[model samples]
Each structure stands twice: as structure tokens, then as C-alpha cells.
Target: MRTVVFDLDGTLVDTSGDLIAAGNACFRDMGLGDLLDPARDQKTAVRGARAMLRLGLERAGQLDDAVVDAQFQPLLDHYARAISTHTTLYPGAMAAVDALTADGYRVAICTNKPLGLTQQLLTALGIDGRFHAVLGADSTPTPKPHAGHLIATVQAAGGDMARCLLVGDTETDAKTAAAAGVPAVLVTFGPAGADMAALRPAALLDHFDDLPAVVRNLIG
Candidate 1:
């Protein structure tokens, strides 16, 4: 079957707010209140926990792996508790997924987020059933930007790697698609916004409403 793989954070949902809040929660634990700005650091937020933690620690002159490592789990704990508090699905996200499925495409999620947390967030959003598979950072020995990770996800979804495409919002996604020899469609609404075009993906998606057409053009 043809497959459509999506990145979790910035691709399908705006998870930056929750991610930033979690990082701030870690800072508060260290007696540093709100070290990261929600609006300004949104890009870093979607990059994952470590990036947010490192940015906060740097701002506080405490850039140490030990500090970040120690605070990492706490940050994840905080995020897991309030994963969807400020996270929201991008416009037409569900509709697009449905359209693809109706068109006989198998859809899946391949995220850099840990499997447990990814499942938690998707479940919280009440949309976990929408995907055929949800592969996360720890789902395999390797993660995004590695062909094996994406290829493994495709196989898990009962898809042919030759007939797969990736929809995402960052360079990581683009690189992963490239490594897997699949076409990549980068969303313009992500942290990098219109500038995501710099990554030179196979296509640039401005909205989920336009995704089905894009996927057809690329994969069919």
C-alpha cells in the first residue's frame, strides 16, 4: 500500500506551547522561573526536549549535560501531564488524513518524540485511531534522518517504501525522506514558516487542505 508518514510536533499539531511550558516547568524546579519564552523559542520547542532544556540552561548560564539530563525526565513528566493543554491540531489536519485514507492511502506517524509520550499525546487528542502506525524516536534503535527508521515505519504500516511520502515541518523530516529515497512535503506553517523552503523538499505544503492533492501528485 502507498503510505503517508507525518511528523508529530510541528507537522500535524502546534505542540510548541506545551513543549515550552514543560521546559519552563523544569526551570522552575531549579528555582529559575520561566527561562524560555513561549513565542520566541517556539522553534526550539518543536526540536524536542533537549533543545528546549539546553536553550533554557544556556540562558541561565547553566549549560551542562548533567543539568539537562537530570531535568529531562521532569520536563517530560510535566509535558505528559499537560500535553494537550496548549497543543492544537493544525487546520484541516483531520480532514486531510481522512481524505488520504478514503483514497486508499495508509497513514502513519513517525516522530522524534518518545513512543510513550507520542502515544499519550495522540490519545489525549482523541485521534490515536486515525493512524495505522505510530513509530517514535525509541520505537527502533535509530530515529529520523536515518533511512532505516522511516523505512521501518513504512514496513510496520504494511506499506511499500517505493510508494511512500513524508509530510513534516523541519529539516529533520526532509533529511529523513531524502535518506529513505522518498518524496518529502514540508509544511510552511511550521516553526520555520515559509522559510522551510530552504530545505528544498519535494514540495511545500501551506495547508492541510492542500495535502491530498500534493500527495497524489508526488506519490501517485
Candidate 2:
């Protein structure tokens, strides 16, 4: 089956709020008083804990490896407690997944998020069963942009790598697809907005409703 690999954060859902909240929690504990802004730091939030922490510390004028190390686990702990509190799938996300599944595509996730947290969030969302496979940053020796991560996800899902497509919201995803020799469709609604087009992915997705046709065109 043709594979559809999705990036979890900005691509499939808006987890930016919770992610920023986690980073802010770390700052709050350090007496830094919530240095990150949800609206302004959404992009960093999607990039993962280190990016969020780095941005917050930079804004607080305390950017350093020691501070990042000191706060990393605390941030993750805070995030884990309320991971889904402010998270929500983008409009038409599940509908498109259902449509793709019905159309015989093997849907799965390949994210930079850690495996345990990814599974926890998926289970909390009650859609853990939707994906044929879910591979996280720690799932393989290397993650997205390294090719092996996405390839491993496809193989685990019993999918055809030659007929695979990646739906993501960042330059990293585009690079991953390029490395894997698959088409990458960058979503326009995420933190990168329409500017994601500058990454020059295989295609630009303005809406999830447009995805099925895009996938069909790319791999079929």
C-alpha cells in the first residue's frame, strides 16, 4: 500500500499551546516568570522542547546549556501532565485520515517527539489505533531528515516506500521527504503559514480537504 507519513506537531495537530505552556512552566519554576509567548513562540514550540526552551531562555537573557539541561526534564514533566489540555487536531485532520484509510493508503506517524510521549498523547487523544505505525525520535537510530526514520515507519506499516508521501508543516519534513525520495506536501495552516511554500516541497496543502487528491496525484 502507498504510505502517508504525518508529522505530529504542527502538521496534524496544534500542540503549540501546550508545548509553550510547558516551556513557560519551566521558566516559572526557575523564577523567570513565563518567558515564552504562546502566539509568538508557536513555531519554536512545534520544533520541540529544546527549541522552546532555547527561545524562552534567549528572551530571558539566560540562554545556556546548563539552564537547558536543568529545565528540560521539568518542561517535559509539565507537558506530560497536561499534554492534551490545549491540543487539538487541525480541522478535517481525522476526516482526511479516514478518507485515506478507506482509499487504501497506509497512514502513520513519524515525529521528532519522543516515543513515550507520542504514545501518551495519541492514547489521550483516543486515536492511537488510527495509525498503522507511529515512530518517534527515539524509535530509530536517526529521525526525520535522515531518511531512515520515515523509511522505517513505512516499512513497519507494511507500506511501499517507493509510493510514499509525507504531509508535514516544516522545512525538516521537506528535507526528510527529499532524502527519502518521496513527495512532501507542506501544510499552509501551521506556524510557518503560507511561508512554508518557500521550502519548495513537492506540493503545498492549503487544507486537509485537498489532501486526498494531492496524495493520489503524487503517488498514483
* Residue-level lDDT tens digits of model 2 in 8-57: 99999999999999998888888999888889888889989998888888
Candidate 2, 135: how far from true, in Å?
A: 0.4
List ranges where model 2 is wrong by over 4 Å.
Answer: none
Instruction: Give the Å shift of residue 202 in candidate 1.
Output: 0.5
Clashing pairs in 2: none
The estimated TM-scores of all candidates read 0.98, 0.98
TM-score of 2: 0.98
What are the per-residue Cα lDDT tens digits for candidate 1 across 178-197? 99999999999988776788
